[model samples]
Target: MEKDKWDKKITYPDLYLQFGSEERSFFKEEAKHLKAKYDELGSFCELKKFTGGHDYIKWNEEFVKTISKLLKT
Candidate 1:
């Protein structure tokens, strides 16, 4: 991975992330890194954690919530 690409300061669209409580450790770490990167770039980023694992039911619920948030914004 290119360090400059990852560290570049540029405009970015709003980000909304949904993670499950039982998600893999690697995924959680990646999410945290992304949040930090977005923050460093002065972009809007939200990370929401739910009490569930990687499944369709949880995904469906989070999808609806994400849509609602986007619509409201």
Candidate 2:
């Protein structure tokens, strides 16, 4: 979705996205689009790219890192 199409009246929470470099093209494009939209809207958004694929183990590690970072904020 485009940034202009987003509802400005509704508040959006901070976005934290974790994606693998070896992930599918479609998913990566979607994440990039979302990040672009958030950037255009001037909202807080983070996108972390890892050198891996769609694996649960990596996701679990990223999840822990995300949680830890969130906790520190």
Candidate 3:
């Protein structure tokens, strides 16, 4: 079966119950926001790698690092 066709078997609630109601709600909200952001980013898919000129090596490296940092956030 395709991965996308599969339902989520369980959720955060089914895990440890030490979380209070507020914490659980916050976790769900944050998860929703992150999911929306990733979907938005996925919609702007890149077609191909942008190869850089030799002279732009430093600039390209810095650009990649910045993108990585942004993704982490």
Off by over 4 Å in 1: 1-4
Per-residue lDDT for 1-73 in model 1, tens only?
A: 1253654656888888878889998778777887888898888889888898777799788889899968898
Best by TM-score: 2
Kindly provide the TM-score of model 2 when superposed on the true structure, using C-alpha atoms: 0.86
On the 0 to 100 scale, the lDDT of residue 70 in model 3 is: 60
Residue 57 miss distance in model 2 (angstroms): 1.0
lDDT of 2: 0.85
Tell me the deviation in Å of residue 41 in model 1: 0.7
**Cα-based lDDT at residue 69, candidate 2:** 81
Residue 60, model 2: Cα distance from true site in angstroms: 1.1
Q: What is the lDDT of every predicted structure here?
A: 0.81, 0.85, 0.39
Q: After superposition, how far is residue 58 of candidate 1 from its true place, in Å?
A: 0.6
Report the C-alpha lDDT of model 2 over 4-72, residue by residue, as the tens digit: 478656557899998899999987988899888788778878998898988889989998999998899
**Consecutive 10-residue window with the lowest summed lDDT within model 3:** 11-20
Instruction: In angstroms, give how far residue 43 of model 1 lies from its true place.
Output: 0.6
Candidate 1: the clashing residue pairs are none
Alpha-carbon error at 25 in model 2, in Å?
Answer: 0.1
